[model samples]
Target: MTAWLPLESNPDVLTKYIHKLGVSKEWEIFDVVGLEPQMLEWVPQPVKSIILLFPISETYEKHRAQEHEKLSVDPGVFPDDLFYMRQLTSNACGTVALIHSLANSKSISLEDGILKSFLENVKDLTPEERGKALENDKSFTEGHHELAKEGQTVADPEEKVNHHFVALINKNGVLYELDGRKEFPIKHGPTTDETFIQDAAKVCKEFMARDPDELRFTVMALSSV
Candidate 1:
């Protein structure tokens, strides 16, 4: 959330890309990872959700950018915002270490759909276990909604760090926020993630066109630092 690159400086590439929002299911974002091996790996993934790192949010991204170039703005925004943005960018960046860990072992007991199915098909499970399972299911499915609530007001990802600064009413109208991502105000079109990864890869290839060195990585690196 702490990207100090005055939004006025670098044109909002996302806005431009949003204008080109045709029928493609891809993710195009600028996640800064300073010569890090992990960052380089997920560079080509389609990013449906973007936790912008421009201006630079983390210490590593900031440190690298500082060493590589002169920074004209503050890169760090806020701790809460950073944590929240991390959630959004984690999956898109193709590096979800925590998710991968939780997904296994409890694959049949705790995941989103798998657990839901288990509950639905269960005929003799303890009431407490059933309730616990239900609670976990709700938490897992509400990820997007939770993020939207925190981020919607800050149309720009960096601004998400200062959502509290936005006018309450105006904040309610922003898309990344709950008002926009929610079903009522500005419902997002139903976009299946099945093709999302493919779409992201295609877009990356298109952007890097002739640059063979920037080719997509086979492994999805979950961490940038």
Candidate 2:
């Protein structure tokens, strides 16, 4: 599988990347100072989505396995319009997460460019097929590579990246966790436009609580600039 340099969780770099990929300037990425209520207050209103970067440690892997098993028997309601795709390439989670964040956000206007075109082409494809489409799209891949290099600390493409990213969005009042590496989008219960940041923050807190000693987690929101 092809591997690209991992993207740092820097708002400026991410904002630039999304802008380059066709997301309108009306929306920009901003760091979530903390998961607490006080910190969420600093984030701009009408947050479109939240992206989380966390370590892919044994603890996370184990929990993911357990969660998958439990959800397999009782998968909750999946919105037919939910946009999700699998991550087929190594180190592509950041880009996948960004795509998930933007694609599902109907409120965010997309320009006629790489991301907009890619999403439209894959709108009717299965999740796996969407992943394949992304892998084969030269324009999208080139854009990702170009922006990945702008990170503060770019890692070698061949090096193993221990961290992964996931996007959270409120889709029709339900909060969903969209991780391309996962088999399916995980439902995180109900949420509203006004409470999306707080709801996502709760989930982020849960992730931190699972691995108390790990401190590599980062959170950011896509909101009005």
Residue 48 displacement in candidate 2 (angstroms)? 0.8
Give the runs in model 1 whose Cα sits over 4 Å from its true position.
Answer: 1-136, 152-203, 207-221
List model 1 lDDT by residue over 1-225, tens digit each: 112211211113332222232212222234333233444445553223322211212443444345334323432222121111122231121112122211221211332343235334432543334333333444333432233333324334344331110000111112121111111111122233333333333333332343345433222211111
Note the Cα lDDT for every prediction shown: 0.26, 0.91
User: TM-score for model 1?
Assistant: 0.19
lDDT of 2 by residue, 1-225 (tens): 888777888899899999998888888999998888988999998898999999998989999999989988887768888999999988899999999999998888888999989988999999999998988999978888888888778568898899999999999999999999988899889999999999999999999999999999999999997
lDDT of 2 at 174: 92
Task: Determine the C-alpha RMSD for candidate 1 after optimal superposition of all C-alphas.
Answer: 18.8
Sliding window of 10 residues with minimal summed lDDT for model 1: 163-172
